[model samples]
Target: MVRLGNLVNAEGRAARAAIVDYGYRTGLLSGLAPEPRERQGAWLTPRRLAILKLIAQGQPDRKIATAVGCAPKAVTTAVHHILRNLRAEDRAHAVALDHQQGLLTQPLVPLPEHRPRRVFSALEAQLVEALAAGQTKLQIRTSQGLSAKTVSRLLTGAAAAAGVRPRRGYAALVDSAYRGRLLTARAVDRASAPCLPERQHQVLIGIAHGWSDEQIAHRLGLSTATVKTAARLLYGTLDVATRAQAVARGWDLRLLGAPRPATRATARPGAPSRAAA
Candidate 1:
């Protein structure tokens, strides 16, 4: 039997195919190869088919609009139109039909070779060291003249490469560490700064929220590549080693807010109810 780890390794060896294969297998992505749409006697327009492909990539309405250079509302209408025409239940079903028809290509899932481990880049290693010494996103961006978005991306990508995927509650830690680093980096020079668009800001925030580049781009009306670029800028600015750290920093700085403290504490007085902080 092929081990799952082995499959990931094999998949990782090939960039294009690996993303789909590993992403879907790891549950990071969905709808890689959906069932065929089974629509007959009616042909789909090239535009409709194109929209289906985008949907398969996890693009939302806004993303579809940007990709097609149309309004977000228009994209929504187009999607409904396509769904009606295909007579499919939803977008996934439409994609499945397109894939089976060979109108869209399906990427196969890759098997892992051995134990999955973290990967790091030279810059990421340096950033990790800087973070260990306490660096800040703004400071790094000022000194390096990189955008916050890029820095955030680098950190997250590094974390993923390091095989340390963040699950739940990792956000708090990442946010704290990120803010600490930002403060450290800031002491150097305050004047120089990178220009980060508002859209990019939202994208980075989404990344910190654990959204994928595709999802972020889709939600924010940007391209996946643009989303990725923002992430890269974020990491560069923070001088952090991974995305997790950037997110952690964002949280610490209230760039990403934590859950509001419990409005009411219902412990009995002096009964050793709750441990002292």
Candidate 2:
């Protein structure tokens, strides 16, 4: 069979090396195990650079040493330092990262002509926005009341929809989302302080303090009906759907820094004793 013949003739590790060499360059594959994120604080020498270039070309230790005019043992030692300094997993990983980071401009292997584009479903798009909004998987789970397994599935599904490996493709997913217009550059800008009306501000502060609507009504010297109205207005102003969301959004928008503790020693008339919401 043609398939059998192709498998038999496969170049094995050389093919894999070529994939890593230009897969990211062509925008197809980002290796599942990413380069380690430790700072690249160590300096690289010219000899080490030559070794890395040869390694990227899928050369063996002997070839790398001969190309760099060094002993094969020295090539092995330089490799150890390259992995440490770049926080790379191995030679191929270093090659991928080198291309990704623009350390080595020209890949020895020819770049692929085209790469598969990343795509996202509608649900995945929404998840990307939530992630960009600073919600973590755990926070999303609790807020959305999703089971742990369901949360995992949804995140994994989102990654798949974006054509990335689940969990391991966090950076890739985010990058694709930005490229796809699911998240905006404006959202990356720092937000200005939120300005709410006086009544809404009081209600929001009370909510942040974990006070019930009844407690907020009594403390702010407003009727329960008025307190409810203010809370509704506060929610609208923050564009949040729930109290917890409002609190989080408040913190995000710089509206709620630290709680200004209750200053009045004297309780207002009809103020109920403090209790959590």
Candidate with maximal TM-score: 2
- The alpha-carbon deviation from the true structure for residue 221 of candidate 1, after best TM-score superposition, in angstroms, is 1.9
lDDT of 1 at 226: 69
Q: Which prediction has the highest lDDT against the true structure?
A: 2
lDDT of 1 by residue, 196-264 (tens): 333444655665555677866765556798677767777676655566566544443444433333223
| Residue 20 local lDDT, model 1 | 45
Using all chains and alpha carbons, the TM-scores for the candidates as numbered come to 0.30, 0.31
Clashing pairs in 2: none
Candidate 2 lDDT over residue span 161-180, tens digit each = 44455533143454333333
RMSD of each: 18.5, 24.8
RMSD of 2: 24.8
Q: How accurate is candidate 2 locally (lDDT)?
A: 0.55
